[model samples]
Target: MSETTPVSELNEAEARAELARLAAQLQRANRLYHAEDAPELSDADYDALKRRNADIESLFPALKRPDSPSDQVGARAADGFSKVSHAVRMMSLGNGFDDDDIADFDRSIRKYLGLSSDAPLSYTAEPKIDGLSLSLRYEKGRLVQAATRGDGEVGENVTANARTVGDIPHDIENAPDIFEVRGEVYMSHADFDDLNARQVASGGKTFANPRNAAAGSLRQLDASITASRPLRFFAYAWGELSAPIAATQMEAIDRLRAFGFQTNDLTRLCPSLSDMLAHYRDIEAQRSTLGYDIDGVVYKVNDLALQARLGFRSTTPRWAIAHKFPAELAWTRLEGIDIQVGRTGALSPVARLHPVTVGGVVVSNATLHNEDYIAGRDAKGGAIRGGKDIRVGDWVQVYRAGDVIPKVADVDLSKRPKDSVPYAFPTKCPECGSDAIREDGDAVRRCTGGLICPAQAVEKLKHFVSRKAFDIEGLGAKQIEMFHGDPVLPINTPADIFTLQNRDASNLARLKNRDGWGETSASNLFAAIDEKRAIELGRLLFALGIRHVGEVGARDLALHYLDWDAMAQAIDAARPAALAQRKADAAEEAERQAAASDNRRARVKEARDAAIANSDVPPAAASAWSDLIGIDGIGTTLGLSLSDAFANPDERRAFDDLRQHLTIVSPDAPASDSPVAGKTVVFTGTLEKMTRAEAKARAEALGAKVSGSVSQKTDLLVAGPGAGSKAKKAADLGIETLDEDSWLQLIGDA
Candidate 1:
């Protein structure tokens, strides 16, 4: 199946087939990128494939193979080098992309430590070098061995190659008798360019980038080849220290420098988050000028004691985070524009661009946002960048940062062709030719075709079987597409998926005999479908893919309504309530318009009046609307989306038809016998013994309502070390609070 195939369309057979394909593909990629240092795929493409594999596995948990790529990290150590197991593992750091993410990281740390926001917490910020990691072991103040960080637990021994590097000190003074300094092995940009120039002159292979050059140089089987290449090392951390080097991370870095090791010059100890971010910006500003390449900045808790207390997660340190710079930008020609219809019928425009490298990843497409963006106007209709509209032939800047979708940043007006014309935004559904409407306050224009729109119907069906929705085993995007496209064995809707076995059995030829399907696999698929006949109410609601009803929304609705029948009824009742409110608003607008004395006010009043009239909701429907909006986390937008989906005759009929083929089970009520049963509980900070998800799941199992924030209604607050504002709020509200250990005791898990 193509990567663009929706996850919902894949049947069990297709999912299994895809899983096997992903496994083989990722394994080869890992070997090429990690072992051979010759990656064929871009990091973005590789990540996308991995994410797709994970999503499929989530949707079909039973089909998760023993050799699943998600469970592996990097390729096994190349056979050329002797493997040296690490005494203290050199772990990677998790990433923080934006200011909010950095703030959340700090808040999370404070919460985990049970510290107030204003408490004295400091962090050491340093450039995160874009190079290979290395560990240098020293005994009796003399370098004994060096190794590359191959797979965390064990690494390839590069002692000979490391010894050739000028930055690596053969001996140290005033250092711990035994120490293992963990740092990066890198080639400076100048040195990399020089080396590449020399290689090209000598008719040898040229390196792609500095990082690859450094990695290739270090991994050379011939030590003399590494010796010829200019390599440098920067010691930032240590593993298996014989004695304490310093009390804080910054002090230790200084100690490392004193011991004849180089450290990043820009490394600074920031007293607070503001200082840290300022330092980060400063480093980012100086990044290009710096001889060595750096992708981002790493921040770690300054206090050694605090770092110890924070400890480590499975693959990364809890006390440290890498705040990456914004994605690199590149000017590329906008080839064309394509409109993609979502499950909700929202038409999103995509800018097809000439292939260009941005931050080492190839970019061929970027999101145009909406019609306003295409017309060189902001969402509010204000001119953007002097109202320079992006034309088909115009050169546009595209950017991709962290996990964000690639987006068009700006259009180069100078590069726009004289013949370029303003792109027309479609007003009709491309799939069904129905009117595509732009609702007031909505940036997107959506099709009113509902299920009749092939794009909308296909997308909705895909969403229904997605990982976060019904997650039916053996039913994935490819299978859905295949079955939906088939005239003789069509699976057009969620209900149709359930009727597949019956339809296949009635056919002259069995599905088992079809190309890519065997008797056993077909039987397994049927069994998988049968297994999902009874599903959770939340999953059922989420599967519907109502415009604004996301996973959390579905859960909130399920928690509030308890039963599918109740939720359906509430949504049905909300329609009239919403209609009634609209009518009441229209009447008020009419009075305001009549009393308006000026043209501007009259115009404003007229718009309001028009909006109210068009809404056509009766005031009597207010109660249902109120009930829906009253649900925690359910806002007016989401409430209306739910009501509208239920109110639509076509959608309601589809849902009714689907419900008949399945059993919807309500979640069990919170346990009443337990001490915290039926009480609202809020968890803050990082839990020590278990993850926050695990804690929440356990709490819900015992009948407690786990809320995201603390309030007066909260009976208890389970605070971890970095409990920060939530703990303070709980204290101020007079709600009882317990530390991780105390909460564990209360839960009888201590």
Candidate 2:
């Protein structure tokens, strides 16, 4: 498209079409740059495209597309890597372009908190390294996992690769039992030069830059390759800490250094915005001589409490921003579009761009979110860019800035090919040819192929064996995929996994003799599988990979049911009752639709309510729906997911088949020796000696069933300061009441 045509000159239809094209183009560029380590445009060109897209979107605010590139942070996780979900989602930082931008950021923060200009707000300024982000998860002072920051919420596990980096500690003394240390994994300029020289001498491919080299080396499937590369790590932030590391950002860095992790020595605490700007300039001046690549300076609010109060925006923290160096830009051609299916059955659209260079990196692909995104429509069906749409054979601008993925910045409409047509989204799953359905309130359409779809099946199996599920010792995503796809040793379902030993025994060919396996390993795997044969009810439920039944929901269900057989029986009985209730409601609705006499409608409604109240549910299942919804944290969404899974005939048969090969262990009841054993208890207000979580854990451990609200079943009430309705309810019921101190004394902790 010609740059001569002003964005304002474009009509509503033209703007909408252009916005759709730009959205698709930019998303493709993101995938290519972030996930594939390739770029098709320079940083400046990409920025220009983005600026143009923003201008049009501003003029036509009602047409802002849902898949706007400005809203996304990173691309989806690439294939061949095991995904790791972060406890605390890793977020991207907002950018500051210049000194004025830094001042604006400071002013914005102060305004958000209603603080005076002279208020003493401290910040920590550190160099923002141009490298890959890695999160090291430690449990009980031992490094358990190391993962790359894939898409904030989920990442790729790279523990083996991370272990090879000398700066990353394998163990830390006096560290919190559960902590996630976040930092940059980078390569020094000297090391990069040396590695490239060695590669040339060996006739191997050489890296274009230190950042790319470090990323490629760290993401290697082979640990030996990562170990051979000279990689260094610097601790900066943390996630999912068991306890507070320090009160301020700088102090937390010191704590990290004390725990044997390397921290940037240049990190400084700035008392004011001017001090932060000065530090940023100093870092910028020394950037070339720092031995490692640095893109900019990051400033974060020092006080942990203040940081917590500031909280987060849509995709970034309000407490911090990354002031990046100027971006580079370039132009490229839109090649084609492709669709990829994810583990969760989401069909993402990808852009194939003519290869170009942006910021010394090559890019060729980008992300296009979904159908609405491609059509210049928002997730809620609003027009984006006045219904602009992207088409093939269009000249697109691309750009990239410090650490951000390359993206399509704009489209040159003047160069658009006449024959190009608006892209049509597929209605059927490309992988399995099943009907692709988009649920209400969901942005992406998903394939309903289930087990019949190879992609969905493999993904489900991976989730089934994930760390939070069955957690089989030797069976990981890679092994599960290999076994499932193997013709001779197929593991198509949960039952198949259990019957593997039998299948192997029946055949002369052994798993032990296979590549990457031995007698001990095979035996150990079988032993692990056997150990999991008597899996806990909670874990079993989670391992089934039921939609919306997360670890917490599974645990709640298990605790309420206690016994496997009893839970299954209740579920079975509740399914029919739920059906009966639905039928009765339908009859009442039909009566109302018929415009029957008021008396007749009233009678129908009464009968419907009575039938629902007296549905055919076993005693244990009579209150199943109510009890499921009543559990603390259990909501209607999760309750429906559980009930639907139980009611589905295919799912029920699958569960029965799996149960035949394994024993589902019942969850243990609360301790019986304590004085409060088997007694339902409720805690109201606040306890001074301990937090609510701690109190609940202690009570459960001491055999008390801690209810959120006081009820007729409650035998004891522990009331602290500000005890209100719950305490009054206990007094009304004549249940025994005790102050916090008195409750502690009764529990033998006074």
Best by lDDT: 1
lDDT of 1 by residue, 463-544 (tens): 7877667777777776777778687777877888888888655542467778888878878888888988998888888888
Query: Measured by TM-score, how close is model 1 to the native structure?
Result: 0.71
Q: Compose the digit string of candidate 2's lDDT tens values, residues 1-750.
A: 333234533444566688898788778876765576666654445554666687776545545788876666666777868999999988988777668789999998876665669989999999998788889999999999998888788888999999999999999999888999999999999999999999999999999888778888888889999999999999999999999999999999999999999999999999999899899889989988999988789999999987886789878899999887767778889899777665556777777788887666577765566788777788756786567776778787766554233455567778889898888888888999988987544688888776677877776777677666777888876688678868888888778888888875643247877899888888888889888888889888988877777777787678767777777776665665556655566656556545454555576677667766766656555455555554544655566556766776656676888899888787776656889876777788867776565677778788776666665667898999989988887889899999989988888888
Q: Please identify model 2 stretches exceeding 4 Å from their true place.
A: 1-331, 358-360, 381-387, 392-414, 473-475, 485-488, 503-505, 508-528, 569-622, 668-750
Per-candidate clashes come to 35, 46
Q: Residue 198: error of model 2 in Å? A: 32
- C-alpha lDDT (0 to 100) for residue 323 of candidate 1: 91
Cα lDDT computed for each candidate against the true fold: 0.81, 0.77
